[model samples]
Target: MTLREFMVQRQPALCERWLDLLLADYGEETAANWRRERDPFANPIGHTFTTEAPRLVEAVSGDGKFDTVAAAALEAIIKIRSVQELAPSRAIAFVYMLRDVIRGELGTELARGAHATALATVDRRIERLALLAFDVYVRCREQVFRLRQDELKRSVASLLRRWHGSELPEPASEEVVHLSPPPNHAVRR
Candidate 1:
């Protein structure tokens, strides 16, 4: 079989294994439920894997110019994982699972030397995907941090407003509200 055909044939198993490994840290129950639950709302993690992994595999195997699509897929995965209780390393490490799959599936063909370059190319692409995942992961984290900071600011402002009994806040309670009677009304002829 041609290299591309082999890769295509193995995509399902690759994605399944990848998802299992990715969720393994959450424990066997999470991994098992993720595999079992096909519902999008109940098992978004599994949904993302089933939905994006095939496209990613295609992008990785495409001739030239797959980076954009691959990055999109990686970013989507990162966004979902980032919201979960995941460390940054664990969040992006799923990208490496593809490398493991490729190595295992293609090892014999790669050993024949005829397809060494092809195997190397795929490996290189997987590395690039990891970098993309990291970049996306960082951006996702920054967004989360910013959202938290905004929430904190809003909560503080609300508390201060409640304490001061007005929407406008003062540095000190002694500050006077000087309402100079409307100048135009006072000057009306």
Candidate 2:
């Protein structure tokens, strides 16, 4: 069979192995959701893994072109991983699992195989995906950092507004009672 035909036949198995490796990183309880539920709303992670992973494998296994959908799927998965307690390396390690899965799927065929070139092509595709994943991971972290910085800035601005408001004396009887500042008074921090 041609390499493309082989990859097509093995796509589902590849996704399954990749998902199994990925779930191994999480707690048993959390990982079980991925193995159990297939609903997108009920189990988004599982749905993404099962659905996107195969699409990604199919896309890359074709011509190794960069597909926006595949990249978005990778980004979504990475975004989820970025929030977890995993180290950055651990969070992105799932990308490398593709290599092992591919290797395992074509073991005999790859050994003294006339399709060595085709096998190398698949490996390169996985490497490209890994690089894309690293980029996604960096972006995810920067987005998280930006959000935190924005929140902090807002909180500081609010506190300053409150402190300044407190300094401006309240109007009496809820009316526009204007009063001049106390003579010779200066506010200091």
Question: How much RMSD separates candidate 1 from the native structure?
Answer: 15.2
Q: What is the TM-score of each predicted model, taking all chains together?
A: 0.75, 0.78
- Tell me each candidate's RMSD, in Å, in order: 15.2, 15.4
Candidate 2 lDDT tens digits, 1-189: 977788899788778888888998887988887789977998887877777788778866887555666677787788888998789999999888887887787677667776888877877777777877777787677667766766565657757668787464332323422121222321111
Best by TM-score: 2
For candidate 1, write residues 1-189 as lDDT tens digits: 767777788778766766666778779887788779999998887888778888788866767455455666666677888888888888888788887877776677656575667767877777777776776777677777766766565668867677767754433312322222222322111
Query: lDDT per prediction?
Result: 0.70, 0.73
What lDDT does model 2 reach? 0.73
Give the residue spans of candidate 2 off by over 4 A: 156-189
Which regions of candidate 1 are displaced past 4 Å?
Answer: 156-189
TM-score for predicted model 2 compared with the true structure: 0.78
**C-alpha lDDT of residue 39 in model 1:** 96
